[model samples]
Target: MRKPCWFLAPPVSRAARWRGRCCTGGWRVRALVRDPFSAGAAALAARGAELVVGTFEDRAAMRSAMAGVDGVFSVQPSSPGGTVTDEQEVRYGITIADLAVECG
Candidate 1:
């Protein structure tokens, strides 16, 4: 069976590389993003990622995205600005990890 991979808030650079790998049948890639219509998300989809519309804080979305996932690559925002504080970022990361464990 093909290994399924999930990418959380994947940046363009890493997404691009992963997309290439997925195209070559390396593994199945599911990209989780807040906005699926965004240009970056569109690009990832165009390259072969199965887009999972979601945010770090959305538990339902995270759970749905992580179902049957073999591995996960979380890429959260670096600067905790705009409504998100450092503590919130940590919480979001923990939430993702927790959901991964729960789903697995």
Candidate 2:
């Protein structure tokens, strides 16, 4: 087998050049967005790919939003006006991951 394409942003792309989902020979691709507009989601859906849109900001809300998803892509959401401390960001990331695993 060649490899799995995991488009996990710029940093993670070196390992896997993530591309849109292709069902031709067992290729699966997905994108994590805060929301999936109908036009884009419909286009991706037409190609037999999935676009996960978590319609929430809070952890519990996001967990609920992604309740049935197989895997989760999370970012600790940065704000220009109010940036979180590194420690806080780490904790937030962990919380999201744990919650996602729990819900899934």
Cand. 1 Cα-lDDT: 0.76
Pairs with backbone N, CA or C atoms under 3 Å apart (clashes), candidate 1 = none
Q: Which ten residues in a row have the lowest lDDT in candidate 2?
A: 2-11
lDDT of each: 0.76, 0.47
Model 1, which residues run further than 4 Å from truth?
A: 10-25, 80-83
Candidate 2 Cα misplacement greater than 4 A, ranges? 1-57, 77-82
Residue 65 local lDDT, model 2? 48
Judge candidate 1 at residue 46 and give its lDDT. Answer: 83
Per-residue lDDT of 97 in model 1 = 86
- Expressed as tens digits, the lDDT of each residue in 5-57 for candidate 2 is 22222123332222333323465545444446655455555655555564323
